[model samples]
Target: MMRTRPLKVALLGCGVVGSEVARIMTTHADDLAARIGAPVELAGVAVRRPDKVREGIDPSLVTTDATALVKRGDLDIVVEVIGGIEPARTLITTAFEHGASVVSANKALLAQDGAALHAAAEEHGKDLYYEAAVAGAIPLIRPLRESLAGDKVNRVLGIVNGTTNFILDKMDSTGAGYQEALDEATALGYAEADPTADVEGFDAAAKAAILAGIAFHTRVRLDDVHREGMTEVTAADFASAKEMGCTIKLLAICERAGDGASVTARVYPAMIPLSHPLASVRGAYNAVFVESDASGQLMFYGPGAGGAPTASAVLGDLVAVARNRINGTTGPGESAYAALPVSPMGEVVTRYHISLDVADKPGVLAQVATVFAEHGVSIDTVRQQGKDGEASLVVVTHRASDAALGGTVEALRKLDTVRGVASIMRVEGE
Candidate 1:
């Protein structure tokens, strides 16, 4: 009979998610051990400041040395929750070298250097599962990699960052500007003080890369994701969306393009129809809508991030990796089989809502119409306002390349009749 000993695990960070991982390890020890078919022990915990007070974990398990913990050679698995690009990446690689599997929630590291990490795991024949890295606690990664393994997903649109979603939700419901909604989110602990990652679309872009990689079986890096944040969106955009039966949500969209020969990923504030399921997703919650050729439409919705919620995802990966280890078999490795080129944003085809300020005159509409026509973009609908010198001309365009629309805007800006381009919003969920 094979000797069954406890699976010794080490945590590389003792922050919010790490703390919950430790807590759950102790609270649900028996159940986890039974499911894992062996003992699951918190062999060690690494922290930057070991003196920080942590509840539920015995002081003996804590250590200030993170590198030493991964070097413990005896460790069966290493769980890393530290979010960064440098030390976390190095440490995870070290763990794989030391013959231990790794589970991480570092989206930045994953999005930037995922191919390297996956190659490392394949070389060592060890499991590397990161379910919590994207759409925290939503069980998306494993399902995309394993359960939906056979399905050919065509599109994945997600509200993956909770802080931005909360702020945007407030803006959508109350017509609040970016700062006002951000202040409210910060007061409620939904946003941090600096808020660069969430408000600037950095966080969503990172998540988009990861989701795109798995959903489309392509290698998508952070640089390939086109990103536009919600800071520039105003009440006028929201009002216009409401008038058009739409709601604005920051979305990370991944689609196969080039006649289904390539993949593209982008993060931007978009107008989703009020009747769509993603439009109903409010507050700080997250949701991902996936469309496949045979699977049809599927939606995954849950808490995007929190200590306990993220911990749930971490534990799920731990169980899977541990099981694969015991079975002497590895999990699904990186699947970039399609190896499709990540297309740039300008090449993507989508509908647009362009609002422009023009002179309230008869020939103004005709001039604007000519500019769009010159760029090969057809207008779906046109709305004009104002009785005197000031007028607003809103043009909703049919599906066209972003490059074509951009050229039309540049031409209109230099025109003698058009005053300014008020705003341009992408329309989706139609």
Candidate 2:
């Protein structure tokens, strides 16, 4: 019953991920054909460099003109691995117009303009799959989109970026300062030369936006996500975390409000108890913890990024889109029916750990306690260390609105007894 005629596939971008996609498509052609019920062909590969040799790819099929390749009217599928916005967006729109499905791994593009791209695909009656967009090969998108379609997901917490996680993990295990840990990560190739995007939490914020949208069936954009970098995490922070039996990690958190009318998405460095599943997600690994009405708690963990791991995700999407092409059908499209408003960070309620440098005096503690009382913030625990007329007060507060916590910290800073605010960290995974 398998069709003998081949289904033409056009590949855009032949860099790390794109190259691996091509390699897998060629090496597993027969298996793919059998599974998809039709032979799949790499009709053309679009790249910037034409003279460079592609080991498993035919030289005649290589072209520098990506637009021309996607414009081909005969292509059944277009695999876009070119990250970023510009040409990727244009080429994807063109591919849809020219009657081809798209399987992309562009997280930034999807987080920024997913609705528009989804509209284009729906207008052309094409499938747009991006399993490789979020957590490398962890299979997060499809599960949130399809497998959990019948279930109501309430919260998704994860360590989405490997670079920040590696840096933070080093800080936790070795008691290194932020710069020292980041330097080690850079030398180990876990971090890029610039490392701005990863270290600044922009990368995790983009992923949080995407995950929030799919998990909540809502429209969450990149700008909607509240992001906080890990640059300020210090060795003293790790020492405090150890005292509390916790570890630090850069986490992407997406949750639906109690009323079920609104949602929130944020990325920040937090201290999670060592007993939590996510706290054990060390090194460059990624893990997402999902809580739903029926499923209770489910965790997805694995390598979050790498050439081969990300390429594996891309290829999975390729096979899926290819099968749909053979069946003359499309997979699930965008599901923004909820249309929930994304809440701002001020409205988010969570616990906080605050450290303060204060004058070592009896009445200073009472002054600090009054500030929390004035702001209606309940203190869970307080630890004080004294040395030569100066003392460090570490206060861990219970669940309170971020606005309230910010107010308390501001008031504490203005107090005559308080010398400085050492660090303020959000405590999670209780």
Q: lDDT winner among the candidates?
A: 2
lDDT of 2: 0.94
Q: Quote model 2's TM-score.
A: 0.98
Which stretches in model 1 have alpha-carbon errors above 4 Å?
A: 1-4
| Model 2 deviation from the true structure expressed as Cα RMSD, one decimal place | 0.9
lDDT of 2 by residue, 249-275 (tens): 999999998898899999999999999
TM-score of 1: 0.98
lDDT by residue (1-430, candidate 1, tens digit) is 2336988999989888999999999999888988888878899988888888899888998988788889889988999998899799889999999989999999999999999999999998898899999988998998888888888899998899999889878988998888899999999988988999998999999999999999988999999999998889888999999989999999999999959988999999999999999999999999999998888999999999999999999999999889888889888989998899998889999999999998987788998999999999999999988976899999999999999988888999999888899999999888
Worst 10 residues of 2 by lDDT: 168-177
Q: RMSD for all candidates, in order, please.
A: 1.3, 0.9
Q: What is each predicted model's overall lDDT from 0 to 1?
A: 0.91, 0.94
- The CA-based lDDT of model 1 is what? 0.91
